[model samples]
Target: MRVVSLVPSLTEAIAVSAPGALAGVTDWCTHPAGLAGVVRIGGTKNPDTAAIAALRPDLVIANEEENRQPDLDALRAAGLQVLVTEIRTLDQAFAELDRVLAGCGVRSRPDWLDAAEAAWADVTPDGPPVTAVVPVWRRPWMVLGRDTFAGDLLARLGVRNLYAGHAERYPRIPLDELNAARPDLVVLPDEPYRFTRDDGPEAFPGAPAALVDGRHLTWYGPSLAEAPRSLARALRAARR
Candidate 1:
């Protein structure tokens, strides 16, 4: 079955499961590198519907949050089969993986999926929760807010998001307000915005900042297998 994957995590999962089945993928689908010759449809939020439909794919995989409704609607309007996924927690991540794989014609579960489940299954971090404001963007400072998969992932690592109860999923807050929160730490992810050693930490002089791999924290695919350990190391090194 021919498939076009708009979500980066789903792109990697499907590619890993059935290498050559992907006829098109979004430009941001960078994992499992060397996706040579794959047609680039555009970014997740603004996929080229015409280009996607032109590929004549039997199926297109998308996420409710990562993609826009109008784009998915246009694809459906053109008579294309679109599978939309929603993942807000680790359990939802696993279940969504199954749904995507099955939609893409992979009946058997991938070993990476099994490994990821095992990695997060018994995670019980010792200590009080580390309060953090995780910034995904720099300019104007957009942070991970309520009901986010990234926030949920951090919660598993004993890193509680300071803005997890905020109304917006991704909220833009003033730097002063974030600092005023007096969080124990500032968690910085490398994608959507690349927060480096010299870039994000200084803003929160009162707290240590942990620069982490956005893929591990945000993407729910093969990387899930190593996210617990990798995130743990970064959060640990951020200690004051």
Candidate 2:
């Protein structure tokens, strides 16, 4: 089954589980590196519908959060079948991954998916919950808020998002306000924005900074298998 994947995580999952199923992929689908012959269809928010349609894929994969509605509409209008996924938590991620893979004609569950489930199953909070501010972007400073997959992952790892109750899923809070929140830790991921020890930590003098891998913290695919352990190590190091 030929498919075009607009979601990065799904692209990696499909590439690893059902090889040669991807006819096209977005420019940002960077995991499982060396995607040699796959056609590049532009970014997730602004995929080239004409290019995607020309590929004649049996199915197109996307995420409600990462992809634009107008793009999905255009694809459907052109007689393409689009499978949009919404993942707000780890459970949803696993379920949606299964659905997307099945849509790609994968009859059996991939071993990576089973391993990811087992990995998360073994995770328990190492200690008392530590409140944190997880900034996804800088400039205007957008943070993970409300019911976000990243926030839920952090919560499971014993890190509570300071803005988890906010009305917006990703809220742009003023830098001053974020500092004023005085969270115990400042959790920074490398993508959506590249937050390094030098770039992100200086802003929050009051809280210790935990610089974690963006893929492990955000992407929900094969990386999920190692996220709990990788994130736990980063958090533990930050506290020390």
Candidate 3:
């Protein structure tokens, strides 16, 4: 069946599990290294609906948070089936992956999915509980707030989010305000905004800053299998 995936994580999942089933994907679907031939349907926020419709795909995979409602509505209005997923926790991610695969007509679970489930099945947060502020973008500085998959992932690792109770999922707080909160650590991932060693840590001054893989911190796909360990190591190392 032909598919057009707007979510990067879903694109990687579909491309890896059901290869060749994807006829179109957003330009940002970069994982698995070589998705070169698929039709480029622009970025996640601005997918080319006309181009996606032209692909005549049997399914279009998206995420509620990553995609805009108007675009999904337009796609449905144009007679395309779109599967929009909501994942705020690891368990939700596993369940959603199963549903997405089933919608694509795959009856059996992929090994990566099983591995991912197994990876996080018995996690114990290793160290003392630490409070953190996770910045996703720099310009106009936005941070992870309230119920979010990334925050949940960190929570699983014993890192509590400082703004997890905030109403907005991603709130644009000024840099000075974030620094004033004086979290035990500042977790910086390299996507949504590329926070590097020199770029993000300096802003935090004396606060411990953990530079982490954005995919491990945010994306919910096969990478979930290794994320728990990968992020834990980074967070632990940054303490020293």
Candidate 4:
């Protein structure tokens, strides 16, 4: 079936899950190098509905947390069947894909999930219960605090979130406040931050620091195939 995947993570998912079925993707959907030439439908939150419509897809895949409400309704109104997914945990991700594939009449999720789970199991889930801080944005600087997928993923790896004391999922935090909190690991995401190794080891000389790919940590869709490995890789890189 012809499909337009507006969700960025699903771009990776479509590569393994549905293969050539994707007709269009959001600008952020750049995982599979082959998608480089595909039409860019704008950002994840603001897709070009006209471009999506011109693709004439039989199905459009979106995420509840990723896309705005109007986008979902507008796509549906265009008479294209839409599949919306919301995932809070790994199980939820699998469940959603099950529905999505079923809706598309595919009857199975892409095989990457099985491999991901196996890879996740190989990690032994044996890691120090370190405290971590994940910065989402800069300038007024916000951070993921509690009940977020990053928080849960850290919990799974036996790491606890330092800012989880806050009520919001992502709380605005001052750099000084974070410094004082003394997290075992201070994380900077690629988005809203764009941290690079060139910034140097002495940048946060007091603690372990890492510049992580935000999508791998937070995207709970089929992209999870890479997540378990990415987390383990991140933790190992932290040793330096």
TM-score for each candidate, following the candidate numbering: 0.96, 0.98, 0.97, 0.85
Off by over 4 Å in 2: none
Model 3: residues >4 Å from true position, as ranges?
none
lDDT of 3 by residue, 10-57 (tens): 888888888888899888899888886789899999999999999999
> Taking the candidates one at a time, how many backbone clashes does each contain?
0, 0, 0, 0
Most accurate candidate by lDDT: 2
Residue clash pairs of candidate 1? none
Model 3: colliding residue pairs: none
Ranking of models by lDDT: 2, 3, 1, 4
Task: Compose the digit string of candidate 4's lDDT tens values, residues 39-67.
Answer: 77899888988779889998898987788
Q: lDDT per prediction?
A: 0.90, 0.93, 0.90, 0.73
Ranking by TM-score: 2, 3, 1, 4
Cα deviation in Å at residue 230, candidate 1?
0.4
Off by over 4 Å in 1: none
Candidate no. 1 TM-score: 0.96
Off by over 4 Å in 4: 197-205, 221-223
